[model samples]
Target: MKNPVLVALFCLMQTLILAQSPTPSKPRILISTDIGGTDPDDNQSMTHLLMNSDLFQFEGLVSSPSYGEGNKKEILRMIDIYEKDLPKLNKHNKKLAKPDFLRSICKQGRKGNAPFSGYTTATEGSDWIIKCAKKQSEHPLWILDWGGLEDIAQALHDAPEIQHKIRIYWIGGPNKKWSANSYAYIAENFPNLFFIEVNSSYYGFFSNNTEPDTINTSDYYNRVIQGGGHLGMDFKNYYDGEIKMGDSPSLFYMMDGNPEKPERESWGGSFEKITYSPRTIYNQTTTLKDTVAFCSIIEIHLKGPKIEIPSDSVCFWMEIPYGKTIQKWPGYHLGNGDYAIRYIPKKAENLHYRFTSKIAEINGLEGDIVVSNLWPGKKHSTDYPLGNHWYSDKSDINLYDEKIQGGKTVLKWRNVILDDWAKRWKWLK
Candidate 1:
């Protein structure tokens, strides 16, 4: 007989090869977005999601609003457009979910942000989430929270048994500001919950860090996306033809890389590790932020005894991005310990900007302060809505106060003007 040991070894090698084969299985996704609410970028994200529908095993599309309003009608409106373009989309990939099926699965969740407790009874959307979680699946269903977490929170509250079956990828930053109660409840109570709080990583979609070569939102809409088809035309009709889909990174993260392993560098963005909580024995590493360069402006507020400067000496300092010739404006103390400077970068890449002061007391920090795009878009004065700036909490809405406690300097970057780009591009051919 042939050597039994050699035969066994050959079989083991075959198994190993199959295991490393790079072909990743499709991830199951349930999109919970506030599409029709304050920001319309979620609409752009929805368009991208539908365009790449074959990549995911979509379970649900819940209209979970951030504050007290939602747009189930808007969800249907997109579905209507998808239905018109369904035949052509199917030609590209037959796995695309039928419009009728998507319509059937689409449901309206809670109409606003959650109460202090995070639970405000179960809604149709919340119940749907629970139902989807109960289904048999080899992979954990990813709950992509594009808006408030009230629906997901409710689902978890109602059915604690499904906690292990679902993984949450929350696009925090501004969303968390509006849904603080719900976010706080989840963070405080559900330490074991597999959650990836993407606070600032989503900026990669719009950032020009990989400019010229990489197709950003502005370039994508101007070149390939705008006026391409019905979807393109529809996209141009919103945000004045600008291709700002900030929330789409959640989908991109899953679409490009191995969804089973999020830590790997992907189109969504690379993440650093952070300790979850101090109270929990189950210590876990959470995604801190995207490592991508200058996706957004870095606002540094120098304070404490380290930043104390004498009245006789000039306290101004200059910050220059490492390895770059450009230098941002000098930092000036507004009052008290608040020494602030705003940097609008030319490129989007992770680089340490050396902070140097002419005064001897201000010099010598151990390491270069790590700066990356942690917010949405550039530091413009008109990116998001006037009343709903991304950095300002709706509950604690104060635009005038740049210094809001904690000795941190809050930036007054521009708010996005919805439909401004589309209105400007009305003449687009």
Candidate 2:
């Protein structure tokens, strides 16, 4: 006979461990930001990063500038604030990385964008990257480039062997424009590097299409972050108490779920495959919500082999763009079995439009009807690659040419509400 009480206690302990260990093993991350310069957005991004520091085993915070300004001291200043706030942060989650630990990882990278060739002498930051990548770890080192690629370029140039050990997520758009020369160089040479250029998708976090109550970065400061605590005060000081951390999506992708599965939806946004250049270009996948933010009209085109179906019952209802009334559009059969419907989004609030049929099922002759945003497609007036606006639209193209340096990648920003605010203010409650 077994001791009943002891068996019960052991079972309870196992359950507790499982509950506490809900978060997967932490990912290795190294943040390369250009704060204290042209834009103060990086300050907000860094604050968000520190608040979620428990999610990643931070490797380094390098000051890698593209143009106007970048200083390692600014990063240290934020870390000092984080040091003071650690006690409060620890109250919510005791496993947060210590301020001194983050301090030791902070280093300065390249001062500005590299020359057109993209190779300059390696610096302290580049060397640090090489060292971190070489260190034995099961997970790949995720380098979040909040600024230029000069330091990254330099790292790859010096140690070409470590390309597989690193995965780069570049917040490129305007940043790409600044680092055109270096970006071109990387694209031309390192065709096998694993990289994701975050262009328009990050803009979704601060888009005007969503409601202010949704707690996007646009109103997150006023609603949740402002009066929280030490972390709150530091965040306020960054951009005059505004929430414009466009770079937080990079961290978001790593936080909520497995960052490796970018194809599935999450708080950060979803991604889809693109034509593989030297680096695999993963563009941010768009949803119905992202339709209105980037375009004035949303179009749907469906095509399939000519089939027999109940046409009388099929109808679509969409919000009259920016209005309350719901309008329905009748599906028109275009000569063959092809079907088409066009509707402008009614509201800037959310995506709530769909096509419905009264029939239970339909017999198809050939294949599934392709549903896509036809308006964003290339017109007769456009070139092979199409216009740059489509980079953020529903139909986006992946590009890697040195001559065409306009669109890197466009992401659809999500109006996600996370618990960072609730945890920071938990003590008060």
Candidate 3:
């Protein structure tokens, strides 16, 4: 026979311990992607997200394009595919979000880049961001930015208070090139916001130089992704089954380890805190001595003859190496003979630019700039020392390979992450 008092005490202790243990909860996630755009990699990332939908409480799926033509239709199309494969996915994970729910959350953001001010009129996507951030929850909303920052900027501009309620993980290298204005706005205004800027670090996803040929980008899809499911069959539509889902790191960061500690090692990649992001301003046309870092925002302010014209009418045309054509960027008119145009050089090359506007004096105003291959990291000096912002530490020797910067961070976990993903793929089949 057992003593009733001792028995009760033991049961009480067990109850207390159970009460103290924290319950695991899915993270609140919202993805802003540039899908069906110039890079079809977002399609791959979106497929990965839908297949692993059980892991997150997805609040929104926004189409936010800064350069190419990406829209909500592309997002809905992927969800349609997911809907077809839902039965197979549900067998493994019953918590996967429904297709109707995903379609309901899909919203369209800005069609083009923001102006020099970094924000324009709010769109449906920005409104959705605000709505989702304002939801009552203990967990902060994690925004996985796989595209431009225009929607995020517009959301912040519209609802500044949401900053405290949300965290951001931005994949910002080539995407930054298109969304420089919005990126500058968020970096400058919302310094204390919890943000992770993975500029070059995400290149690690495809850096298979050190990996075996079986897991290489060219062969991985055939080995692991193909013949898995509808999503798997559609994988070949983009990049011909190559794994260039650079934005998937943001998802991986949330999937594998403690997301709150970005500095700590995880399957996604680790990052370091920095005081500032690179932004350079030129009062006049840049000379050969005024070399700017590639992918960093550069602003040229030209003093032109005073003329009465709307600021929106002004445009700056530049000769770019990648596109092999002259591209036009919007210019802004400031009061008292001042005009400005902000540009991000996508490639390391000599750039020639000319301004055009209804104001004849500013029209045909030309300038030259020397762009270096350097990325906007700690190497550049900044006058604006914002609060500690999380970014890839270029100084970390362990995170880089001989050819790719910050590639080793994700490369080290490639086998483990992909093996896990491969198991999930088997579920679909």
Candidate 4:
């Protein structure tokens, strides 16, 4: 014989406790980053992740620098700092992953972007991705891509079966500029892969457009993160301690909300389903009339005299306006003297290019291409139909920011997200 009032109170308490508790099972995550690369913000993001390591089942930390001098050594450097901070982090949560285990998972991916064909060869990091995706688990692996997609592209190229078992949240934009070839390869081949391409949307994580003064980029690290711990102290080495973890939104997206529904509002910026992604092809050197969208993949096909060279390497060189420097990309020989090169325009400008090969007929072949300001969206007709992919909808008025284009979706949650993180920073103190 139990009292009805007491039983009702007990039920209410249980409901509140359940609502406050984190998900019983941790989400499996594998982070592929270009740490210690051109962008030092990765250091900041890594520090943030280690501080909150308990929230995820971290399976891998891969160094995947597409450009610049970044490698697994940088990841190990961060782990070294984490090792010192582990005592403090463990005080708050003993579930924090061990430094030795994290070091074991640290792998080096490709040193540069993929060739015109997308994937070149598999690396330790790419192999690890395939291995983790194949592991027996009820939940899919969430790959947080903070760098180029070269490794992921290579892994998928090697093991297509894992496409359905893994999800990717890539911090694109500039990274897309670096890994355009691999991006095109994946978009065209693995159309069914569950991916969230956060191009400009991730900018919201650091946007100061409409944020509280306390957590503004210039002040938050000093106020909330500076004295937090060893990791916090080391965070000042990059960007002079200003918080510009543009890649942190991928982490925030999984922190407090349902990652299964990306369209729904979350601390991470909301994304939309886009059937088509921008892409274009040219049979010859393009003119202004044959303008292509910025950041979109453009493939150029050219014909040369039917002469086979003993060597397999062919080069595509594009002349830049600045200092009249030439940047080289790999060109593929498509049998019968046909050659092709895939290029991604990083800006709205005209580009001049030439091909160089051992075959004299293809050597010094020059052409011009016109790039437009048009970006990928409904307004752009030149796009590839991706069967199912999620990306930041640049057309969405609600998510638009005058400063960052499509970063408002994540910008709107700045205060709430930072406040939550600020509370966690206290644990290190």
Q: Which candidate is the best by TM-score?
A: 3
Q: How does residue 8 of candidate 3 score in lDDT?
A: 95
Worst 10 residues of 4 by lDDT: 310-319
TM-score, every prediction: 0.61, 0.65, 0.90, 0.87
Find the candidate with the highest lDDT and give its number: 3
Residues 1-429, candidate 2, lDDT per residue (tens digit)? 299999999999999999988565688999988898889899988877887777788999999987777899999999888887777677778987888888899999989766435667989999999999999988899998899888898998999888889887777755764565466567556766666666556665555444444545445667777666777777777667766677887887777677666555655655554332211111222253332321122334455455565442233222222255644344433435555443322112345444443322212211111222222222321112211111121233342111121112212224333454455555422
lDDT (Cα, tens digit) per residue for candidate 4, span 1-429? 199999999999999999999766888999999998889999988988987888999989999999889899999999999899788777778988899999999999999988767889999999999999999999999999999999999999999999999999998877887897799889989988899987777777786675445257788888898787788889888998898988899899889677888888888778788787777767777766677766678777877766564323354454334455556667766667777777777656787766666667667777777766535633445566776655654556555666455677878778887787788788888
Clashes of 2: 12
Q: Give me candidate 2's TM-score against the actual structure.
A: 0.65
Better of 1 and 4 by TM-score: 4
Give lDDT: candidate 4, residue 80.
96
TM-score of model 3 relative to the true fold? 0.90
Give me the runs in candidate 3 sitting further than 4 Å from their true place: 1-16, 211-214, 323-327, 346-382
Candidate 3: lDDT of 358?
62
What ordering of candidates by TM-score runs from best to worst?
3, 4, 2, 1
What is residue 337's positional error in candidate 2, in angstroms? 59
For 360-396, candidate 3 gives per-residue lDDT tens digits of 7666677788877545533445434567654653546
Arranged by lDDT with the best first, the candidates are: 3, 4, 2, 1
